[model samples]
Target: MVALRNLLTALFLPVKLCLFVFHHRVGRVRAARAAGDRGAISIELALAVIVLVGIAVAVLAVVMRLANTVKGKVPTDPVVTAAP
Candidate 1:
């Protein structure tokens, strides 16, 4: 259980760090746009959203496929074994 917890923490840390960085970057871009820079903040936001949505959709597809595969492998009924 300790090992499992450590593994989960290790895996989750990077994802959290990435999200934090993305948020920070977006905030900075927004601040720059607010400061009257003739920048492509809209384009950057659109691209980021598109990429995130694409990743989400891809992950959903993979999860659905895995769920279906596992469901297909499960027995529909309980098995009976004779007592020794």
Candidate 2:
């Protein structure tokens, strides 16, 4: 169970870090908007899109890994039906 916990922690660490950075950037964007910084909003939005895409790719990779693991554990067999 220690290994599982470690694995889970490792897997989620990057996601958590990404979320924290994204949150910080959003806050910065909001502060800039409040200060009447027009171009900063566009730059912030572009940065946000890039971060979101990274997060999405990371999530997709994790999901695909999980799917492959599950598929490997499933049994493959042909069903045989008997008629009375």
Candidate 3:
């Protein structure tokens, strides 16, 4: 049983080593690819657009509120009455 176990271990060692090396190399390759500067501009542009949109929304909200307040304060009648 011990010899059989040894034989099995010897047979599997090379396969395990190959798998480990392949996985490590593939992981390194993926990491390098991900760390590269590809698509950086697109990401930056998306972020900028998001920020600008947020600012625009805030400005529009403020303007709308101000407009509503001003509209409420304006009078419909323009005729001035003279005091007797």
Report the lDDT of model 1 for residue 46.
73
lDDT per residue (tens digit) for residues 1-84 in model 1: 999999999989959976996888779787977887635776777787788789879989999999998898787757889999
- For model 2, the superposed segments whose C-alpha errors exceed 4 Å read 51-84
Kindly list the per-residue Cα lDDT of model 2 for residues 6-28, writing each as its tens digit.
99999899789878977987788
Clashes of each: 0, 0, 0
Instruction: Provide the overall lDDT of each model, using Cα atoms, as 2-decimal numbers.
Output: 0.82, 0.85, 0.74
On a 0 to 100 scale, what is the lDDT of residue 16 in model 1? 93
Winner by lDDT: 2
lDDT of 3 by residue, 10-75 (tens): 989967866785576556556656888446545654675687679769979999999998898787
Relative to the true structure, candidate 3 has a C-alpha RMSD (angstroms) of 26.9
Which lDDT value does model 2 have at 32? 86
